[model samples]
Target: MELADRVESLTPSTTLAITSKAKALKEDGHDVIGLGAGEPDFNTPEYILDAAKNAMDQGLTKYTPSGGLPELKDAIIDKFKRDQSLVFNRNEIIVTIGAKHALFTLFQVLLNRGDEVIVPVPYWVSYPEQIKLAEGQPVYVKGSEDNNFKITPEQLEESITDQTKAIIINSPSNPTGVLYTKDELEALGEIAIKHNLWIVSDEIYEKLIYGNDNHQSIAEISEELKNHTIIINGVSKSHSMTGWRIGYAAGNETIIKAMTNLASHSTSNPTSISQHAAIAAYTNSEEEIERMKEAFEERLNKLYDWMMEIPNLSCVKPQGAFYLFPNVSKIVNQSPFDSVDEWVKQLLEEEKVAIVPGSGFGSEDNVRLSYATSLDQLEEAAKRIKKFVEKYSV
Candidate 1:
């Protein structure tokens, strides 16, 4: 039997592929250092874990509302108001399995066949694929490295068409880790309002920013924009609760209801325990989140400095998130390797180092290195990378 056409048209996630390869090597006794997956190295905080246990003790294991638990929805509303100065009714918010699930549901609920979703390049790997799965086209707007890998308003406007329904904005972005400033969001927001297009803002990495940088949600730029924007976020990245699988969307009540209806039939409800755990995550885990951010910052600063010291690898120093995306084009040009993918392969085979190549992220010259691992692991990975590059740079 033939597979579904939609499934055939999709590409597998390169990030997961590299991560699985690393895991397989480790299983075979190879000392592989995996810097591919975006997960935080930290574990879920004890408080949140305890909350999950407390939920069970309280007999909350029964299925919650498919949209989410009312208590969890209330916490999300408070979170938006507390962090973004945005207000939402329970009708406008829905808890999802994770931010990835939230986005997947939104795309399905919003897009019609052939409708286009504008995606900024060097984006998170899932955005385009999800759009395609929804039978919508992905229109790319370049976030060139010169602009700190952020798209300009002019560029965004130029990509719109009669079929354009929405634009996906992520900051601090995955792969690039660059945070879009308030001014930038306002500019983009103006364009979205001009064209009446939805702005699907992915703020999953909002709480993980470094230094003086802060994440500005597009929906908060103006009242008009807020009406036209849907904010997607979750506890996975922020609270180190990746395994707990709790995420949410805040937007127009009609759209949220539609997404919730879809979830009702597909996945029923997010886990009852996860919803309660997320309540604790949003309401009580501020200190724990800050602590994880500090560890990531320390690792980022040292690893960034080391990567800069390497001769042929150039990268925009990421402002947030635990990943460092280095442009290894120069190294590739000097070496005999035909592409960054090939170079990554050689490094993995020779030094047992694994990194996601840029081609997977719509970029062919760069490689993303997540600093989520410990400093000791990061240091050894760096040493291995340097040795690998030096061998071919000559």
Candidate 2:
């Protein structure tokens, strides 16, 4: 059977591939420690679960507006106002199946064929694929590891061309948990405005930040920037509601209306019960959220230390998010392994540790190990990884 041309060019996700191998190993009765998950280890909070149950009991099972329920939109608006001090009206919001869907919808509405979107290296694996799926081109600018895997405004400016339509900024980024500061955002906002480009800010990991760092939305830099920015976020990471699939996009009314129209014909609406649960997620006290964050911070600190102890593996200390992106190039160079991908596969096969290789995230020198597992599992994974590197040391 012939597939569409769009499907032909799509690169399968390396994250999922490694994870599948890990699961297969476990099924074979091998005690595999998988560190490739991109979600909170914790289950959804009791309050949010109760909200969904109540909604179902009340027969809230019908379709909602393609955008979202008005109340859910209001809760999202309140969250922005309270958290980022940015305000939005209901017209500017569209709820989708997930943040990934929100991004997919944004690219579909904003891009024409041959349009270009600037994507930073070590990006969340989906960004480039989604842009391609929209028939848009993804022009990547590599971020320096010394800069904590963040691209500078100068690099962003250099990537822009006549066909450029938008740029993606995923702070507290996936794969690499680097957060952009207020100043960093202000500088990048200037570049976006100078080039008259849309800014797609994916803040899915906003609430997962650790220590003194805070998540700053690029939209909040100024009112004008806000107009140019579409904020994509969800309860999945923030409230440990990954399965709920409630995500939203907020931006210019016209673009949002267009996305909503597209969604109406596509998904029609996000799940009604999930929207209700999301409302509870946003409205309830953030005690459970804080508890989850604390656990991740603890895991990150210990696991990062353990990983550094492994010869030739060095990583940037992540400010937010749950993954540690360690540069394994030195070890890969010294060891018998020819590539980070090979090292990843061998480690999984021999030491029973599974981690996503960095080639999927556009950097061949690093590999992403998620600390979103239990402390015991993470500690064991680190030990196994260290042993594997030592065994292969040339």
**Candidate 1 residue lDDT tens string, 150-188:** 999999988999999999999999989998889989998
Mark the regions of model 2 whose C-alpha exceeds 4 Å error after superposition: none
What is the TM-score of candidate 2? 0.99
Worst 10 residues of 1 by lDDT: 213-222
lDDT of 1: 0.92
Expressed as tens digits, the lDDT of each residue in 95-199 for candidate 2 is: 999999999999999999999999999899999999999999999999999888889999998899999999999999988999999999999999999999999
TM-score of each: 0.99, 0.99
Give me the overall lDDT of model 2. Answer: 0.94
Q: Give candidate 1's TM-score.
A: 0.99
